[model samples]
Target: MPKKTDRHRPEPTSHTEPDLAKAKAVSIACGRRRFLIGLGALASAPLWPALRSAEAKAPAAAHWPGYADAMVIDALGGPGEYAAEPYAALSDKALADVRASGLSAVNVTVSGVGSYAKNPDETIRNIAYWNAQIAAHPDRLMLVRTAEQLALAKASGRLGLIYGFQDATPIGEDLDQVERFDQFGVRVFQLTYNRRNLVGDGCLEPGNAGLSRFGYALVEKLNEQRLLIDLAHGGERTTREAIARSNGPVAISHTGCAALAALPRNKTDTELRELAAKGGVAGIYLMPFLRIKGQPTADDLIAHIEHAINVCGEDHVGIGSDGTLSPIDFNDEFRRKHAADVADRRARGISAPGEEPDVYTFLPDLNSADRLDTLAGLLARRGHSDARIAKILGGNFARLFATAWSPA
Candidate 1:
């Protein structure tokens, strides 16, 4: 775990501190300085003040609406199904889990996983598939195109699904599709997955080429449409530049602190600070990237969250659990499927730097419909103020939604 940084003038994590991480980020930024345009706002801006008044840390609150009314927004997630069948209609337990999860909205993958820059037909197919799913289970789920619908779904007890993609491949050369996809109910987009594409290099790419002209153009168009941009799975330079150049608040939808555990998929203090200063949010994911050894635990998750809050402030931090709300069975059949998926990613040269054969993709103890409840309880026990917990859970993201989906 990382040693807590002083509230003011925070530094990148030790693994990627001034000696290494900062040097790497600086080197990439300098290498691509000529291409880094439209970043005058970030360069001219000063640090933002703390969002709320309170001690650096506060005691737990027994009150504050508990988990039921927390507006628990999952920044990134998957179809919350744990059954053996794939894409079967939601089981009784599945629906119960989602209904019980109390999630206001979850950014679900409508683009499917992996890079699709070469062919966007698959992306279109994905949108069609998800449309069918929504149509099939109108009672259990609903499409969330705007922020208002997110609130409505929560109030109605249906799992609100915010269509999103893990890669920019879906956009391809058709920049006009940004609004087209938004009209199709897609609201979140990422520049890259785990490899270079028309948009940019992913976190795994050795060259760290950052965003390209097409990537810049795509981002600008997305801003016009007011879509929420995400920088997860992007290279350091890509993440930093995207956050700096984006005209509106973006999200590092799912990542851990590189300082806590040195991994290319994790982020540095510079990226986190810049995103927060601009009123953006960063989500600490649940995966092997959070620590150097053993399976990821609740403590590791908390450490990353606290470190993010410390660097980015309370208002600019939130949860983006990169897994499904349901627990993964690691049963024999699923293990085979998991191995095939990892091998496929590695074969395609898009596997992230931190992935390994024996590692699990999610935290076991915190893997449940009550995951948010368990996490909120843990934060409460850690002395996080109720207001801070509320923001981290969903309030902050709700505000971001309203901003990005403005004029809706």
Candidate 2:
């Protein structure tokens, strides 16, 4: 398992040098106790075992001194976690947990499901909401606009909130809005959600229409602005064309390997490899698309990672999770609410095909306050070298961000 070191554990000076295993360890048993006394609910995080609960929890390795220390970046988080409406701001408890979660930076969608109709108002208001949140909790969270800022977030022990969009609907016919949004600190933008837009068809659209003429123009505008282009829920034609047409690297921020479980949302081997060859990265999510049947397990998550690495090369794959940091409560009440929500999504033509009655939103074993730490431990156990694990955790994403955010 990935072990914890003291918060004082020094970070590695070079990416290609020694791995995290070489970090110094602190052995004061009471130190753990004193720390937990201050943590309150975070001490009893969902999967904290009974036997280990007695021992004072060590400052998590995933917190900053281990693999998570090397510029950890989640390509994107799942939906329903980043809504701007109801004026969601990081609560004190949520802030505390995020501080302890060990992430350097993560992409949070501020736009509603990628529609032009929702673009200016919904997205602008969402940005305003995050503005308020950042202003309120300046110590715990900050907006990340560049790769240097991503590294700074890691060293500063704060979570870098990256604004992203799941769809390109916000720009509408006016491509100028792309540059305007970039000026607004929106860094990552996906081409589509689950349906067609003016740019092109989504993965679920039966027509499979490729990138439009305007779509090509938009890609150039996005490239010109140095904003990262993402092709997550885009159709096969759109995915291929966008990757081929972009002047620089483009990302598939959250996806699965169709070679493992043939879901519409998952990418074929060609898409994975091509994106990697072009210097882009693909992040495998911890969702139902990883399995063909039943709930996904950690084993399933590992398999997808391995497959993505095999196809996309180790440098081009990372964990997007596509899940919230919040633990999913699978009680009857939640299940009922989620079911109704899923049904409503389908009725509205937003639900993807793989989402079913029992297909869980997150993996059971990975459901916890320290899911990122747990993921690093799981990857370590599977024989991934710390260097490779570092890339999988966030190195690749950071490299892409550096390139995309390069000054024009």
Candidate 3:
């Protein structure tokens, strides 16, 4: 996620909600005007839609016997278009895709990352945009604050959207912002993105400096408030230290096993073991980081999942496909845009080693609305029991979320 410069921002439309009255008027009404303008521009690139081939077909959904009764959750994903256009109403296709996804809940990111995320006001506006979405589509969506709400969403057949941050820049130097954002219904907070921040070094930081004094305080505050602490992109020392220090279990929301593919973005076995030992969960992502040199296939994804299960046990492993629900339509225009997007990330210094122009972020063979179900069948064929598949799907993460959000 590169910084959102003015030139790259989209023009403000009527749905941009320039007026604070339209937004859930909060303590930060002072920056309401700037927030709306920034959000209008920020909405253009919610989460980068990495290119995928139009010719690539999704696997036909197989019959997973217990899939219907299972409560599925994408620990680190979006409603797809909810990230793309939160300010505007969701498109018919976007709505249809999410409803068809069979997703019980998704921990959708609602804050900026990288240098552009320095402003707390921008995060506030992102939260407002999501709130507006839930209000607009009450029948289809709900903001998940507690574990009970997650179950309710599944029981009601609605997609519960949980607010989370991929980076902690929005917290800034003020420790109070932790609880402040928590009151706004933010449930999960990641210490860093892919580089250094106030808390500590990210996975890309060569120094590998562990948590700072402020970072330690942030952990305590997060624990006291009962918010889920995510160590997905933290450096080695940071991840290990946070896992040791937190009062409750934390989550490495989306990543691959570094033993299979030694990428900085993927977690090491030591980290995974430590995370699981502390009652934490590790979510394997469907990103290019799963393989070192080529586009990751379904087997490559399964290998990482199997490795994680061996290292952390079935209860600790789950799916966290960083990609959106809708598969990318890699037409000529999309390819052009994809190239430019990669170039921009390279220029901004946020691009990782595996992020090549040709390597898409999702698994091609398994790309579809019913991807989780398809994965279940693949595991079932591997002799994974129905109970094991259920835990890997969402049961484990659901339990972890409930514990993290529970009172101290």
What is candidate 1's local distance difference test score?
0.73
lDDT of 1 by residue, 175-234 (tens): 987877888888999878878888988888889999999988888888888899999998
User: What does candidate 3's lDDT look like per residue over 328-385, in tens digits?
Assistant: 6545665566677789988977787788777666665566777788777666655577
Query: Which scores better on lDDT, 1 or 2?
Result: 2
Off by over 4 Å in 2: 1-65, 78-85
| Highest lDDT model number | 3
Model 1 bad stretches (over 4 Å): 1-65, 82-86, 112-119
Worst 10 residues of 1 by lDDT: 47-56
How well does each candidate superpose onto the true structure, as a TM-score? 0.82, 0.83, 0.84
Error of 1 at 11 (Å): 16
Error of 3 at 86 (Å): 7.2
Better of 2 and 3 by TM-score: 3
